[model samples]
Target: MPRTPTLSFDRGTLILHPPPRGKSWMDYATWDDRVEKFRIPAIQYRQVVEALQAEGSYFSDEAKAFEPLELSPSMEMEPYPHQSEALAAWKLAGRRGVVVLPTAAGKTYLAQLAMQATPRSTLIVVPTLDLMHQWYAHLTAAFPDVEVGLLGGGSRDRTPILVSTYDSAAIHAEALGNRYALLIFDECHHLPTDFNRVIAEYAIAPYRLGLTATPERTDGKHSDLNLLIGQEIYRKTAADLAGKALAEHEVVQIKVKLSQHERDRYNQLIQTRNDFLREAKISLGSLKGWQLFVQASARSAAGRRAMIAHRQAKEIALGTDGKIRILADLLAEHYPERTLIFTADNATVYRISQEFLIPAITHQTPVKERHEVLTKFREGEYKTLIASHVLNEGVDVPAARIAIILSGTGSAREYIQRLGRVLRKGKDKDKFALMYEVVAEDTSEERTSVRRRGVKRSEERGARSEGKVTQLEILPTKQITYGSGDRTSQRAAESSGKWDDNNSLETEE
Candidate 1:
């Protein structure tokens, strides 16, 4: 049972229904006294609030009469042509589907348009607390008459528009699923595997729209989402959306030579991973090992340890001072201007935050604090902020003028999400975005980078093949292989999708 915290409403003397534990003489009676200084321990206040909602405790004559606030006529902001087109697509796509547009393309505006178009009780799932604020503010501003409730890591309310975090929504999905008429999943790509998807299953909202810059998964599968949310109706690339409201950007692939010491540590970690992969393969013959490996890596301490080794090794190669130096160049050149630095680990985030004397945000940061920090960042109070993997997917930080990726989780989904940070439209310039990836030379970082680029390059090709987006130019197919101990060049990387087996390791087959 949740012990209600002592809350002050400035108006009538309001008292929480159920008082906290350790209640002595006065907390015993169920009195309606308004003004009294009291303490309700904060430890499990959420539990108390959740229990109140679960028990239907908040329903009352006065509670129901609080009349929802409404938006003024002057609050309406017209959508751009593309935004209007996206709205048309959303309506035409029937009920449930996902929209792939670059960051800063006014997806929230589109959602608002949908709300007005359909005008049903809607539930918006956000990934972070800051987004909860962003969603509530926009919805409230757009629909001043209606109330917007927020349910994130902590806050949980149910107004006309219920904005929630994905994690919390999934946890109590059985309840939230039935309540809303429409479900709008913002930053939809972050939903990975069955953990989060289970919420979508319970939802009966005939209307569903998912928003993402990159809809593909890190594992390179869109089929799961294609099943839950319908086919991606309108797909717009960052390059396609750039130079308008969004930024036109350049990606600089900064290669850093690893120090011998770091190289030695990285090499050892790779050997362990490769060795484990081999053992798992031998144990589960053919390609069944991949499933077992994934399962093992999913829950076991051993698997987690191995995964850490993989990331730590990659980070050593990727986040070295040499790599940081390259990233620093981007940050320094644009210093005094807003910048976002992303890394694979909290340690690296902390290191950069301390080195530059800037603020940092991670999952470990308190939810309340995150909202404040993001607000400050948006107001340009902080010029630079570094984040561990938390900012990779869904949260929106509007003032990120430049982005630096010193280290990454090696997820193509994550890569695209990190890149999405700076693509939001800016007012000062033609909205230029600078994406810097500091990769260590001659290591798996190079391999990972190639594979990641290849995935995007391939998807763009796939999109072209599907007759959606056309390639700027197509060159004649060509392949070149040098003599012994030489190299090979392939014209198109679309074929790289399949990994060659049989003699994949043969020097000369």
Candidate 2:
């Protein structure tokens, strides 16, 4: 009598015993001398199973530890046209891909539709604790009967449906790799980091969904998402759904000049930094130039002076008095229209907050106070709020019609997110959102502004020229059902259709 071949899970890996006699399993497995068996990464579980089935190899699958769920949403709201199209595309892609929709376009609701369509044990990974809690609340409201648990911020309740931060998910990816049938990564751009990538690589979940407003990463690691989650199956920009699902918006750029005294000091600082760089034979134009500068700046007094001069020059460009004066004028012009003030640094945020008597939020702000500030902003108690990068993402900022960017980095994602703060359509459907970009004239800030906006313009042009607008199809507003078992049942589901402000509190994380 011969022993039966079997596949089992072990600490974020798949183990094959009595090694299947074929090249298919070998493609994904390696000989393990210690266990006298073949070991495969859990991520390749789906491919491995399919390969074995294709070759008529019989093996007992003891790796999967999830079951089909009968999930049904309590609410019966109809999905927007774009949302419907995105959901259909994801399904057509075999239920493993990314969906790109602009902020405030209801990406969360689309994930719910996916859950209903597949109805399996699911895990949602988010970048921040705030989002973890927000998803928990939404899931609880949508599925009153299903037990939704959280696994971050010191709470570790493991239920059929779990929400966790990227840190927590990555920390326990081995134990969680086999527990869920579906994995949805919110703000999926964070998935490509060195630490967080393991969460997806270790998971055996054949079904995956990545939701993000911007999928491009500065490090170019976003390409890894193809292997980790799936390809970008669907995408819709803010312009695509403008005036229908979101408010129509416009961006205005304002250039301000530094005073004579300021310009003189700025020139002196720049000259000093350039002298040091020229002597060191370092060109700031290269990709590694900045890193080289940092390394050289720490070894000697001249290097330290050069670094200081570089910092002073940047401060002059980013925080000039002329920019502050223009900000005041803009605030007065747009008085009381629910405005948000954004800056690159906390020093400028606090400066504007104090100078204009507006509330400010930074990473240093306590979580409790931040919540209160946002609540007040939503309720109209606060007309204006100032913030640094903390409000660029995750925070449920109140709907504001006007956004003023005093300073920021060259990141296109940052620019888009700041613009999105005001793009949400409010009760006044006819209202259009306005964003102002204030740049220092004849300074590096001007170039930074162009670099950020250039990427956006290129994206919009590509979207328009390629005609990526998805035609909407009406889907039935009922729970979708699929068969049981892991691989076979997943294929069956693939065939189916369906789908701020300031406040202060002192809390520790």
Candidate 3:
């Protein structure tokens, strides 16, 4: 009598003993000389099963440890038109792909709908602890009967529905490879990193859903999401849903000039850096060129001086006195409404916070303190807040009507995220959100503003472009107010009931 073929999970890979006699299984298997058997990656479990079924091969599937789930959302509400369309597209694509919807456009609700449609053991991977907790709260409220556990931030409960951070998931990917039948990646753009990619590669989940406002990465690794999750089955920009799912918005650019003394020092620093670049035959025009400059800057004294000169020049451009003066004017102008001030560095964040007496948040802020600050901001206690890159992604920022960008990077993704902080609609449906970009005249900051808008310097003032901006003709309405509080807090208060139409779980990411 011949022995039956057996399949099992080991660490993050699949093991097949007795050597299944078929081309389908052989294609994914490698001969393990030491184990005297064939080994396959866990990711190929679905493909291998399908191929074996087609070939009429018999094998015991002992690798899958997850079971079916009977989940029904406790809340009763209708999804937005875009959410409906995105969900339909994901279903049509065999329930495996990415959905690109702007923040506050209800990507979380769409994920809930997908969960109901599939009803399988699921694991959700987020980029931050704040998001992990938010998802845990939302999921627990949506499914009061289901067991929703967490696998990050010091807790490691293994329920049918799990929410985990990227770091935690990556570290334990091997043990979790076969536990979930469905995987959902929030802010899935983070999935393509070398360390996080293994989380997806090791999982045997056949169904996947990736959600993000911006999917492009500065490193160009976003392309890896195609193979890691699925192709982008559906996408909608903030401009695409403006005035319907989001508040109507406008972007205003203000250019300020440095004082005579500041300009002289800026010129001297820029000249030093320029001379070094010229001598080294290096350019900062492209990513490669910038990388080469960084490599060259670490080799000698001249390189170190050049690096210092570049830093001083950037600081002057990003934090000039003129920009500070303009910021004061804008804050006073938009003082009646909630405002968020964004800067490129923490030093400038502290400077503006202390000078203006506004509350600030940086990476150095304690988690409990950060939560309190955001709570106060949401309750209308603090009308203005300043922050560095800490609030750019993963934090659940309350809805604001005005955003002032003092300085930032050249990444379009960052620009989109900052813009999204103010796009959520509140009690006033007619109100239009405003984003003011204060750029230093004749400085590198001006070029960064243009680059971040996803346009060339010549096209900075051109008509609205895709994924960049929306042109609204409506005038700003008088001080928009959240009736009781921001939509996030309202949803948190009424977690067991229906969600408000104007707001869903809107994270910065």
Order the candidates by TM-score, highest first. 3, 2, 1
lDDT of candidate 3 over 147-224, digit per residue (tens):
999998899988999999999999999999999989999999999998999999998888999999889887789999
lDDT of all predictions, in order shown?
A: 0.63, 0.80, 0.81
lDDT of prediction 3: 0.81
Worst 10 residues of 3 by lDDT: 499-508
What's the count of clashing pairs in each model shown? 8, 3, 0
| lDDT for each residue of candidate 1 in 1-509, tens digit (9 for 90 to 100) | 55444432212112353443433313323354454343222212223344545655542211111222233433567686777877788789775688887667778888877777777778898777668777888877777677778887578787767898888888877566546667798878766557787567655455788988767664545677766666788777666666765677766655666677886887687666656656555232223444565577777676766667765765676567676566565677897778888877798888878887889999898877877887788898988888988887657766687888776644555666677788877565566667777666555554455444434334554554454532321111122222222333332222333432211111110
TM-score of each: 0.68, 0.88, 0.89
Name the runs in model 3 displaced over 4 angstroms: 426-428, 459-509
The sequence of per-residue lDDT tens digits that candidate 2 reaches over residues 238-327 is: 767778888877776666667788889987887888788888877664346777777889988999998898888888888988777777
Q: Candidate 1: misplaced stretches above 4 Å?
A: 1-74, 152-156, 171-179, 190-195, 218-227, 264-312, 454-509
**CA shift of 429, model 1, Å:** 5.0
Residue 374, candidate 3: Cα error in Å is 0.3
Which residue runs of candidate 2 sit more than 4 Å off their true CA positions? 455-509
Identify the leading candidate in terms of TM-score: 3
